[model samples]
Target: MIRTATPADVPVIHTLIRELAAYEKASEEARADEKQLREALFGERPAAFAHLAVDDESGEPVGFALWFLNFSTWRGVHGIYLEDLYVRPEARGGGHGRALLTELARICVERGYERLEWSVLNWNRPAIGFYESLGARPQDEWTVYRLTDGALAALGSGR
Candidate 1:
């Protein structure tokens, strides 16, 4: 079963995030603070939303998807940008991942969103194949960029 996540699920969400990092070979980089996660998800103005996928029989959370809305100026529509999607290692191959993605697509369709998109590490061949099987194509022409910590602070300092 897939359902929207509530603030009470922050701890589980954080744990799943760490699990995802470990799967991606970046366990040390997984440093999401639980309090911050709760605040971000349930604040006065939420920055993102999350969905949880649970085992129907056990009622245990098997996976989660965190996403936010992004505007596509060219398309003149808002799209869902999935920030993170992770299924527990033990729970993989159980259709949980696909179910989460299908729910996201349903959300997009119901809301009239232009698209549902997310990024995957190039080295993750299994993930790549899974996404491809779902008819998701990579945007090869586009490149993602980011500025954080010092660089971001420097830019805000006005040179």
Candidate 2:
């Protein structure tokens, strides 16, 4: 079952973040603490929303998809930017990933979103293929850039 997540699911979400980090070879950078997640996700004015996939018989969570709304100047409408989508190793190839994406598409359609977008590492062929199979073409013409803690500090604190 895939449904909207609640505060009670924070711990499981936290664990999944770590697992995804490990899988992506960025475990060292996955430093989000439980308190930070709870506050950012469930406190006054939630910063984001998540949907979880649970096992049918045991009712245990198997995966999740987290997303937030973003406005596109080109499209002139709000869209859903998927931040994360993960399914447990033991649950992979069982269609959980596809199921999660389908649910998100439903929400996007129902909400009249202009587009849905996300990125996958070039070397992660499995994920790349999975997304492509869903008719997502790589925007190779465009590039992705990042700003880190050092960059943020330098930008804010001019000495």
Candidate 1 Cα misplacement greater than 4 A, ranges: none
Q: After the best TM-score superposition of candidate 1, give how far the Cα of residue 21 lies from its true spot, in angstroms.
A: 1.4
- Residues 49-98 of candidate 2: C-alpha lDDT, one tens digit per residue: 89999888889999999888899998899988889999999999988899
Clashes (candidate 2): 0
Clashing residue pairs for model 2:
none
Q: After superposition, how far is residue 156 of candidate 2 from its true place, in Å?
A: 1.7
Q: Quick one: how many clashes does candidate 1 have?
A: 0
Question: What's the true lDDT of residue 18 in model 2?
Answer: 95
Deviation of model 1 at 43, angstroms: 1.2
| Model 2 alpha-carbon drift over 4 Å, by segment | none
Top-lDDT structure, candidate number:
1
Model 1: how far is 23 from its true place, Å?
A: 1.5
Superposition error at 159 for model 1 (Å): 2.7
